[model samples]
Target: AQSVTQLDSQVPVFEEAPVELRCNYSSSVSVYLFWYVQYPNQGLQLLLKYLSGSTLVKGINGFEAEFNKSQTSFHLRKPSVHISDTAEYFCAVKGDTGNQFYFGTGTSLTVIP
Candidate 1:
């Protein structure tokens, strides 16, 4: 089983500023990590994911994340954030066990313009 944790429940950043939403996980078996963004009244959108290969993974909207096995972390970062980036971010872990997914409470990103 795997459990995900989002360090911050809320983050407020100025427009065009760099932002990071920290995520950590604990698991007994290898798992897949994912960062998803949810817009207001919308379903979650994949921001980035770490299935295998390179530790650094990039995704849409200039978002990127690094997988650190030693630290059990997959933190999401965006060099510059826009008002449109405002949304709820979720950290998820899919365990080796079939269909077992754990999600964090979530972090709300508020971009000030």
Candidate 2:
């Protein structure tokens, strides 16, 4: 079994500021990780993923995440943000062979101009 947690429920950053969204997970088996973002009035979009290969993964919109197996963490980061970057971010964990995915509660990122 696996579960994910988003440490912060909300985060506010000024425009062009760097931001990091924290995520932690617990699982008994090998897993794949993912980060998704949902902009205001929009559906969830896949930010980045760690399906295999490298531990560091980059996604769309200048976002990236590094998978830390020992720490059981997959945190998202962006060097700078835009007003349009404001959205809800979620972390997910899934067993390598499972169909089910465990998702975090989600963190709201508000980019203040």
lDDT of each: 0.92, 0.93
> What are the TM-scores, per candidate, against the unseen true structure?
0.96, 0.96
Looking at model 2, how many pairs of residues clash?
0
TM-score of model 2 (CA atoms): 0.96
Q: Candidate 1 — which pairs collide?
A: none
RMSD (Å) of each candidate, 1 decimal: 0.9, 0.9
Distance (Å) between predicted and true CA of 26, model 2? 0.5
lDDT of 2 by residue, 7-57 (tens): 999999999999999999997458999999998888989999998889999
For residues 26-99, write the lDDT of model 1, one tens digit per residue.
97457899999999999999988899999999999999999899899999999999999999999999987699
Best by lDDT: 2
Off by over 4 Å in 1: none
